[model samples]
Target: MEIKIDDLTGKEIIELIGEHLQGMSLNSPPESIHALDLDNLKKTEITFWSVWEEGQLAGCGALKELNKKHGELKSMRTSSNHLRKGVARKLLHHIIEEAKQRGYLTISLETGSMEAFMPARKLYESFEFRYCKPFADYQEDPNSVFMEKELSHFYME
Candidate 1:
């Protein structure tokens, strides 16, 4: 799989993001959904990437700079065709490495609290993220679960 910075104007990236939003909306109420739409992903502080395999879009993810020492994971979604094939894992590992390289001491994320999000929680746990109080303007919402991973000594070479 090839992962690279995404130009959101591209059809593939737009479609993939659309699908992600649609899926999230189907699984949760619109009020509880916090996944960034394409416009939000275009912010200056956010860096987004799209993964491709054999010329087909496989998945996408983004890292949003919360501050000099912190980052937030955003827009992580693997295409239905790419599920269980490690696309999300690869994109996640790539973003984690990028965060370390950028000298971020912590990477935090907010994902759905519903059963539909259990797999995502498991994936974050596998990368050593632990549940935490909401960070960076987030509040305690029953529909949201917050997680953070400390990278104080994690160096990427």
Candidate 2:
């Protein structure tokens, strides 16, 4: 699969992101949901990506620069048919590489605390992300699990 820096303009990506938001809604309450919408994904601080294979959207993810040395991961999702195909892993490695190249010191993300998010939590853990307190504008919420990984190790390796 090929990962492209997405402009969030294509119909397929819009539908994919819509599906992601819908899934988040099912797994978490509205107030606890932090997934960004299409418009929010278009903001200057966020860099979005779409993974494709044979011209079909496989998955997508994004990085939101919180500061020169910090960032937040957002909107990671794999197409239903593409689950277990390493789409999320490829997208995640790509985002982490870009973050390292951009000089980010750390990257953080928030996902659901429920069982629906277990796979996601495992994925992050495999990448060495550890639980952390709420960052940025986030506050303490039992429904949310926050995680962070420092990028210096990538550079070290």
Strongest candidate by lDDT: 2
Query: For residues 1-157, could you state the per-residue lDDT of candidate 2 as single tens digits?
Result: 9999999999999999999999999999999999999999999999999999888999999999999999999999999989999999989999998998899999999999999999999999999999999999999999999999998844344
lDDT of 1 by residue, 26-115 (tens): 888887898998889999999999999999999999999999999999999999988999999999999999998899999999999999
What TM-score do all the candidates reach, one by one? 0.96, 0.96
Give the Cα error of residue 24 in candidate 1, in Å. Answer: 1.2
Cα lDDT for residue 108, candidate 1: 99
Candidate 1 stretches with Cα past 4 Å from truth are 154-157
